[model samples]
Target: MSQDLQYWKQLKEKNDASAIKYFYDQYIKLLYKYGYHFCQDATLVEDCVQDLFLRLWEKRSSLGDTDNVKLYLMVSLKRSIYEKLKKNSKTTVTEEVPEDTFDVTFTMEEQIISSETDQITKDKLLECLETLSGRQKEVIYLRFYNGFTPEEVSEIMQISNQSVRNVQASALKKMRNNMDDPLLILVVGKLIESFFHEI
Candidate 1:
């Protein structure tokens, strides 16, 4: 097994602070940023992230082992956020349209060093992203930006594999229609470049 898997094994077996801390150091920012995409509140996202880790540690003895820590944590954190939002009536925007959860915006750090072409590309990218439905944007971010598999994306989004495929197809189709460059070459390539750097 890999080092991460080893650590996860230790965590599941030991249920210790150090083991939890290791995961916290690695995943807190990712969970926070991801939760922020849905909630648009930094403090709330932070709380949800902290709570997710706390809950993980508290239930470590009961939790199953996992090789895919990122996908697991993303799935858990998303579920935790929705549960919290539902409990707090003020946080729940609507019961009927809970899947309309994304409001992702590019961060300053995510911005490319400015130039005429870069700015134009950024504008085009943001415009195309805006045209995507909230659920579609979430799927794109989870798939291309975070590098999750289609099955993992379905798990995180609580949708079927077929639904995941359909969503990806539709999102890429929209991007291809709006974009000057090929969807994967320009879109996923640029996202991959900046995404892994920060995460």
Candidate 2:
């Protein structure tokens, strides 16, 4: 197994309050960022993160050997968000409905340097994300932004597992088509890794 998988397995085996605290401290920001992307409300995002950690701690003993704990967190967050949305019918925006405009705090220049991607590539990818259908964007966010598995995403989105795979594949294809710079793509990948690790 990869080093990350090994670490996660160890964490799972321990399943103590300290272990849960460690997980929360490490991943809370990433989870909040993901939740904010979906809900665009800081309070809601914070609540989701809190609820997810609470749920994880409560069910830690029953948790299986997940190759990726980050993925599990993402799945949990997505499910929580879906439930939140479902509970309020007026908040249920169709996949195609345009989300309200919100500030993207990461400036292009900052992202280029911090993410190690060229300004052009960074801009292109951001633009590409905007171009994607709402469902496609959600899948991309869940997959890369929060690291959920397709099965997890399928459950959250109430879609078939195959549909989740298809959306992810489509999103990747679109991103690849838009971003022709290999170096830039590698840098972006590294940035994503850094974001998760540093959080």
Candidate 3:
């Protein structure tokens, strides 16, 4: 293990609150960024990040050996988002929003065009996600959006670790095969490309 991993392990072993806080401070922004990509709502992403860190801290005693803390955070965020989505689906939106409480702004033609393009790209990605089998979609979401190791995912999903890896590999292959729409593929490709660049 690298020095950082060794440091984290020692801190983890000690169950130090400062170490946990340090970990959260270090990775929260990255987690929020990834969460925003999955949720597309700033407030929702903020809530998810806070909840994820809270859970991580609470479960720190039982946390497994993780060489990559960032990956662990990512996986936690992914699972949280999925749970949020599922819960929201089952809940009724009965809360009323006052018209005056909302701000409506007019956009310039260029801004409007850009907004439309972004929506189009997001729609295409959602469509691609929908094309996946339920299990495949779950695995892909956990792997890419959450950054979970296959073993972690398997433990959570109650499947074999190899099965998690297989599902992820198969999902990516199928997504690539189904990328017949050049524009959509280009958009998705750019998004994935940007992720690597940021890393």
List TM-score per model, in order.
Answer: 0.77, 0.58, 0.47
lDDT string for model 3 (82-165, tens) is 667656665545642221111111122331123456766655555566667756755655556555667767765657977776
The TM-score of candidate 3 is: 0.47
Which structure is stronger by lDDT: 2 or 3? 2
The C-alpha local distance difference test score for the whole of candidate 2 amounts to: 0.64
| Best candidate, TM-score | 1
Clashing pairs in 3: 74-146, 75-146
Q: Who wins the lDDT comparison?
A: 1
Better of 2 and 3 by TM-score: 2
lDDT of 3: 0.62
Task: Please state the error at residue 29 of candidate 2 in Å.
Answer: 1.2
Q: In candidate 1, which residue pairs get closer than 3 Å at backbone N, Cα or C atoms, i.e. clash?
A: none
For each candidate, the alpha-carbon lDDT, in order, equals 0.73, 0.64, 0.62
Which regions of candidate 2 are displaced past 4 Å?
Answer: 1-15, 90-125, 142-165, 168-199
Query: After superposition, which runs of candidate 3 have C-alpha atoms over 4 Å from their true positions?
Result: 1-3, 91-199
State in Å the error of residue 161, model 1: 1.2
